[model samples]
Target: METILEVLKKMEKATAREMAARMKIDAPDALAMLRDHEDRGEVNQVNGYWQLTGRASKKPANAVPKKTKPPASKINEAVLVKLLHEHGAMTSEQLAKLADTTVRTVASTLAMPVNKGRIVREKRGNVFHFNVVSKTALGASKLPESASKPAIPVTETPKTASIPEKTETPAPQSSTAFVDTIPQLVSTNGQPAALTPKIIAGEIRKTKSRLVQLEKLRVTVRTQTRLQRSLGL
Candidate 1:
């Protein structure tokens, strides 16, 4: 069965009832189908009517008509930005009038580019001017003029210190030789010490376990925190 959207596409622009009659479906069903298609981003609303978005259907010979592009007077943000770059600076109102768009859009567009450092803002009295800061200007080195000041002279001072002779400290004598006559103590515990391969393998295993545990714990903690905040806990 042909969908309402297909029928609407063929008709170019149609209301719920018109689409329903063309598709042989009830008006409510047609409306529901149209809504679903719209929600899926397959179609769009023009004025108060629904129509298939983008290019018109070429399959149907009797397709109503293709949608005409909006006039050049309707200036978009990109075009406005380009214009601003071409021209020096313009107020939001002036840009809106020039772009044939709302003042809000002009303000928003200006904000994004300014924040990105692609353009710079300057204030003149009460008005603001946006200018594109050239890369050369930003990175250019500032060298002092030779005519400004002469370089200071470097001075060397003579050392007046005296030398000292080195002496070797004597090693400690065996004063504790009397204590060496006492018997030496020994441990009797038989616990097995960790071997080299076993120690290395154990360390690697522990590291892997810690990483996995940390990742899982991080996710769980985030989820729990979100849940707690949502529940006002």
Candidate 2:
């Protein structure tokens, strides 16, 4: 009997019936041999025609390749710590911009408990700033006191020579009196005063001296509001 591969080599490809005829065997026996060859990865079938594995047509290459997403920007822990040390302290937004990454990533890193000992966070105004933990300053409470002591001596002579403080003392009493008169001014005029610069200028020309008093009144109101907030009243 002719071997299946020799028959395939001669015929390029052949059905089981054709193989049986060429090899002088039953079609069922030829088919069983072909299946065994297929299982061994030596032959394959297509449309009831059997062919050697090497003679099978290869799959076509893709014309358009699959797209891949760009890699995300990552900030190493050491690099982040180095940036904070070099730049003093920076907000998460600032660090994110410097590291070419998202603010969420920087925030997540700062939030990690593992970095607690290596980083320190402080609230400056309305935002939090992250800084490298300073081992030397950690125990140095005297550093602040020593720094503040020099400021007292530096500001003492300057405060005594400033004439503005002398003038500002009576300002509180005058500003307090003006605050009471504001309601009366509105009642008499039948409208609230417009505090626009143009209106202030017109009134300044008419009153000349009252603008200074008005400025003092604004400062007093702000101080009062801040005091009330601190006292939680």
Candidate 3:
């Protein structure tokens, strides 16, 4: 019996009927066997023709092509951090140049360590300096004491109240008043108080509308970001 590998090697591309005839087997039986092999990942369909799959291309003497490494931007952030640690603290511009990446990428990498409190910043005029904050310094009190100054006790000031507090009394209710005598302001009068319910309803409606708009915007932003990254923008 001809092996699947042998049949595959003999024909780079072949239909079910063609493969069956070549294998000297019935069409239906050959098709079934081919399908089983395909399901096992030994074969794949390309343009309606069966061919050996990548997984099945491994042979004793055949050298497999080495996979190319992804670009610097695609490198893991953790790996980048380790690389930076080995190289010591460097400016974002310097790191970007070294990594063969954009300054934005280097800034993003630095931001991660800074946010994690692993690094500290010092401002000298306009330029910012970044250094790894030592564990002892991080735990120490941030406030500095004046060596020549003596400690002074805080004094509380005495309170003086010559004026007495005036208690507010509620306005006398009108005997003929109804609905609390508060006029129901309307939109026509340039007062929107009466339209509170309508305004709230409109706000809720607009909120849902805005939410849908935001979701679409988020998807669009993601698509644009992906496209930009893919184009190396």
Give the CA lDDT, 0 to 100, for residue 49 in model 2: 89
lDDT by residue for model 1 (160-203), tens: 34334377997655734422322221113433333367765765
Q: How many clashes (backbone atoms < 3 Å, residues ≥3 apart in a chain or on different chains) does model 3 have?
A: 0
Positional deviation of residue 34's Cα in model 3 after best superposition, in angstroms: 48
Name model 1 segments beyond 4 Å from true. Answer: 1-77, 140-233
lDDT of 1 at 157: 69
Tens digits of lDDT, candidate 3, 47-102: 77888786344556666854543334533356556555677655656666767765
Work out the TM-score per prediction. Answer: 0.29, 0.29, 0.26
Error of 1 at 188 (Å): 80
lDDT, each prediction: 0.62, 0.68, 0.61
Provide C-alpha RMSD values for all models, in order.
23.7, 29.3, 29.3
Q: After superposition, how far is residue 205 of candidate 3 from its true place, in Å?
A: 92
Best by lDDT: 2
Give stretches of model 2 more than 4 Å off: 1-71, 113-115, 138-233
